[model samples]
Target: MFPERLKFPRRPRVRRRLGLGFVLGLWFGFLFYRPVAGLRPLREMGRAWGDERLFVRKDDDGVSSLSEWNVTGTYKGAWGFLDTTNNSSRFPDFKKSNGNSVIELVSTPTKIKGVHYVQGVIIFHDVFDNERTVGGAQIRVEGVYIWPFRQLRMVASSGKGGEFSQEDDYILSNPYHLLGVFSSQVFQESPRDKIWRRKNSPVLYDVEKHCNIEFAAQISRVSSNQNDGERDNYHLEGLMESPSVEEDGDCFSPLLLNATSLNIEVYYNKAVNYTLMVTFVSFLQVLLLIRQMEHSNTQSGAAKVSIIMIGQQAIMDAYLCLLHLTAGILVESLFNAFATASFFKFVVFSIFEMRYLLAIWKASRPMNNGEGWETMRRELSVLYSRFYGILLGGILLMYEFHNYIRPILLLLYSFWIPQIITNVVRDSRKPLHPHYILGITVTRLAVPLYVFGCPSNFMRIEPDKNWCICLGIFIGLQASILLLQHYLGSRWFIPRQILPEKYSYYRRLDQNSNHATDCVICMTAIDLTQRPSDCMVTPCDHFFHSGCLQRWMDIKMECPTCRRPLPPA
Candidate 1:
């Protein structure tokens, strides 16, 4: 019903692109956000409350402590089995009730004598395991935070709660939580206290809860950090000091209670930064491909690239793509961060690169058979099967021997092996571009370095300096060899005695031989006795002027006379 001139075109592609860009920009903006703006109201409320409560305080330390103790907001944590099988086995619902809880510290810590405590309030809600809460229970939390100790000694009692909120109650599995959950930190002597242990310098805490049963917990501060995260990062460790012996209920078994650092912002930032790095590097690789494509690369240098190495890289990029895609679907922010990077990665990295790599490989391979077309297709299929079979086998190996991931990675990065071997075997002349070698080596190393070297990477894999150094040296050595081959000939390292006889194009015609023939390329030669430099001889017994043959090979890498393959000068 709309007028033809006024009707707008529905360009779904453009719309989608714009929408994606907007979402990515929004997430990128969030990456730089230090503190959440939503908490400003709560912080201000705490300040106002502090102003009124300050008049009642006598000690400066008490006043200062109260000001920092604005623990009135929401707290997220869960109960899980703490791997200490001997103790954790006691919890009946340990596996099924491995769920999370959101506790709102709805009021300030009311002081009694010399300690602060939060007791007898609607503190926690919507606690779930594999299923919902069995029956309502009142959770009472009372803690004495001693500044001298930098410790939290909290005891909790339970009865019944009125309501619960199911918002963001994720069906969670421990991702990074299990990394060092069982590990202990080293003791360091601080100037403030002579006895320095993890017990003294603690952060946000831990707790234990049951749907209908009464449980008690001894809470200790695991860790606390400032400026690095939005909240105080903690390793909340809970120990049940008491239990309701009278109640017949499925109570917390092992009593391995924990409070943890929920650093969503830090996670978002890390993912975004890594995504950006990959996007930029992938783009540079595409550019290198473009430059290479511009030149007439007819005689394939597929031999110069390692197929196994390419397969390893292809699998790496494929994993990254899968990772980004899954994370994007789960997190709104990650969708924006991953989209552009994933698109560019396809151009130079993952499955897209495999097709290009294969095309070059197939073109370079000899078609010696009479029934060439069928033979080539079968060979290609066989190559594909072999490549994927190795990849599958490698995956299984990784699964079976998970502890040796570092060694597997080191082996995978040795992608340049094929090129080095090919150059030595075939004695190909400058098969790989110097820029391509350098650019790829550096870019490929970035992902591994970020995963294992960077402390704040979302993966949170511990930095291994020795591994990083070894990887750098390893890749650097490969690039150096390739560059040396480009300048000093492919078999430069081989001894003179071991080298094969190089074919001679500059063969001289002696007095006994009248080897005079016309230059097939220019159709004018017959100069047999001028000089060896004046004429060139093909392996097929054809002759041509040196300059004429040189120029002809540049256009077509085959014999002008016999139509046979010509070796690069």
Candidate 2:
């Protein structure tokens, strides 16, 4: 049928190979080459724009290189647009030069004393490629480090392809001496270089729009291979600026002057405030825990507390600690920023909340009802499955719906709801002290508010006014409901019309019949002739002196005679 498509797979296999090749070719082309607008081959890429080669000056400053200073490490910075995009008169033509690539300089030393070879990859986008449609280019660069002037003189050569993915062909692309020493301005007038788009096969933007551009930057040493001074735990401040470099008729690379450098430092300072805020919140938790201990017996009194709410708080602390700890260990630069904050969180969670959580778990356990072991095991398995399942499912949900993080936070903070229901369900009275409720609510809001409300947050997250206001209102409302439950009775909010009738222990008993019964606790005759408050009645119709039963319920909630469960006062 259908011309015997593969012909039973003959021994020659030529037809099979041809068919497989056709399928694979289509798949590869679909996966790798995504042709979009403004993409063309080299010739159509306008005139091959930029600098012509000139002689490099190697006559050195004649000053000896510092023994400890080695320009052999990585430096990260960004190509800037800055005030230019405001339609500034000075660089009006720069409106098109909007695409930027994050520059990472990997340097190594050579046999020559003050000379360090540098290779840079222009990843994500470059200055020239205007379309920004397809933006990846690699530049193999070598620049002489001028220690006297603190500059990378640009007598540079260009090589293509990616990082060391291929064999060490860097040797072939040499005269390694022909690194970044520009006869133009690179080592000359202002230390700026006009990068050329000609000698390279265009990697960004199918090739057509070859807009020549200039790149001006300043290099500073903030850290080193040899670091000392303040003993700081390793934590990196992840600061990001706009990595966009644009292209027009002429590319205008931003000349980073003193103002730009000052701005960068200012941004870094803001991150310090973030870490400080975290430390402050951790200390607040300590104070809150101490206050709670004085008010209630957490192990036994926590029976009425919502275990989910407490465990949710612990989970939040654990995640925060793990995140900061992992970041500190992986990146040396991050150690100072994340390490101390993580330690504080670890101490607060491990020593403080973990113990609280275990106590809550034990106190909140379901009472045994003489069920078989298999039934209990199945129930526990289901319970554990729901917990870890929510943990994993939440990660995927946040990834898929990250825009709805505010709503997620709202849901997270609704942990108080379980306690409110538990109070009504069990008809318990004053399970949590008022001080604990108020303290926990306020402390929990610290991290979320700093992240979403503060404009100067280190994470560079944009502040959301509407979301912040809504979150505050939502949390306040929850607190208000809990406070109402504390003062106005758990069932006070329920309409009287719908409330089920409850048994009353204070109704006047049969006067003539009960006047003769003796109160066991006080070893006195019952004062039944007095008001209803003077006599207490148990559901079992047993009588006790009112003052005696009140004091006994303080230690244990049980009827003295039958030892049966007693309702809360």
Candidate 3:
């Protein structure tokens, strides 16, 4: 027989104080985390690297060819120049048996505004005579010049045996003012500042004063002893173009010649696919969360806030996932732009995880305590605003540092792994509901994958065949886990019920008892005179409507009021 009225003990003050302190500590730790090293120097270094220019030359003497170029730029393996030149010299004299002088000029113009310019490898064929005497003739390269309001008209013809003939392409228009040539390898402050103010000339002839040129024999040669036969016997040259232009007149930009664009296409594709998959999982989790919230008897304000936060994150994730997928089909610049934006999404998601943990903490505590809901909500709002501001500031800092963001994110994710595992284990010990298990497992797996399988970092330097294979395996594993969770959740993880006689003791309500007139589960009055048989009492002496008590028992065999475990049936 249970007591007609039961009194529950109050939570100790020390425990509440400890919980608050722990939450504050977590918040402070995340807020104060900063990169150990300074970032300004790294940014300056990148800008300097981007300003370096590439110079290339080919002559009739075949000794120094296109196979001698060396690249020295910030975007190392991500971009380069391609040499498509056949081994034949483009020099006019080389075409005739009697002549020895040969020369060719190739240029690729890219959209340049200010300091930012499109970067790619320029591909061209080089031909030179093997004889030192013929190679001695210098093959000069005139510095890149901007043509204001003038377009060059050029014609090309295929020679016998598919060879490109040595023909000069000239502008059809009369004398047009040449903005200037980038004369020396090193220029004063800006390349535009080097524009020569001399009289306008139909053809540029001051090769020594206005162009950076190299003799065919002097170009760096690739040693035949260093590589296997399959190695691409091509020279590498670094090129950096400036966007500065003279605002004095209108200018028709020169067309880029034989420019082969180099970008991380495979990397972007992988990133899009990964984002889609993660978004799908997040959507599924949101649905599960909503369903749980609907069926849950714990209707605390904190619980509602948690559900809302998760829903917001799911929406944001879906939007960003779509943005990433769209970027894959767009231009290279757009692709790169979204790549940076995607990192912000990851940071936001990390912050959401912290909010989620706080929500869980609030939900686990007794909501009936005298704490003000309005005050808690206000505090949460303030914290969220601060976190967002921090994230925005961090993005600016990361953009400046460029190379440090990835490592910091990696470290943060590594730290989260243990926390996720702890949460999963703790949740698993409770009632085994399908949604609960699925949610926990997906979250546990997703965090680590997000940390390690991020496309930007994973595909950074162009992975080899083995790395691609490993990536395939990782994708397969993620898919398999998802399918397994779905199957088990739908077919085998139904909630179990506790037998009434085993965990609960029945007691009839009497008019004389204080709590006998009230149902604690619904917080409604129980009319003992009208329907006394509808009252049910648990082992902890808590009274609830019979139907309500049965439903609660099906979910968990514990006293609803005191949260005490019931005796075994």
Expressed as tens digits, the lDDT of each residue in 454-483 for candidate 3 is 434322221234433454454445334434
TM-score, per-candidate, Cα-based: 0.58, 0.56, 0.33
Cα lDDT for residue 259, model 2? 14
Error of 1 at 456 (Å): 3.1
lDDT (Cα atoms) of all candidates against the true structure: 0.55, 0.53, 0.36
Model 1 C-alpha lDDT per residue in residues 200-255, reported as the tens digit of each score: 32210122332322222322222433436656443334433334353543334434
* Top candidate (lDDT): 1
- Residue 280 of model 2, lDDT score: 85
Which pairs clash inside model 1? 90-253, 91-253, 91-254, 137-160, 138-159, 138-160
Q: Looking at candidate 2, what is the lDDT of residue 69?
A: 39
Tell me the lDDT of model 2 at 10: 68
- Which structure among the candidates has the greatest TM-score? 1
Candidate order, TM-score descending: 1, 2, 3
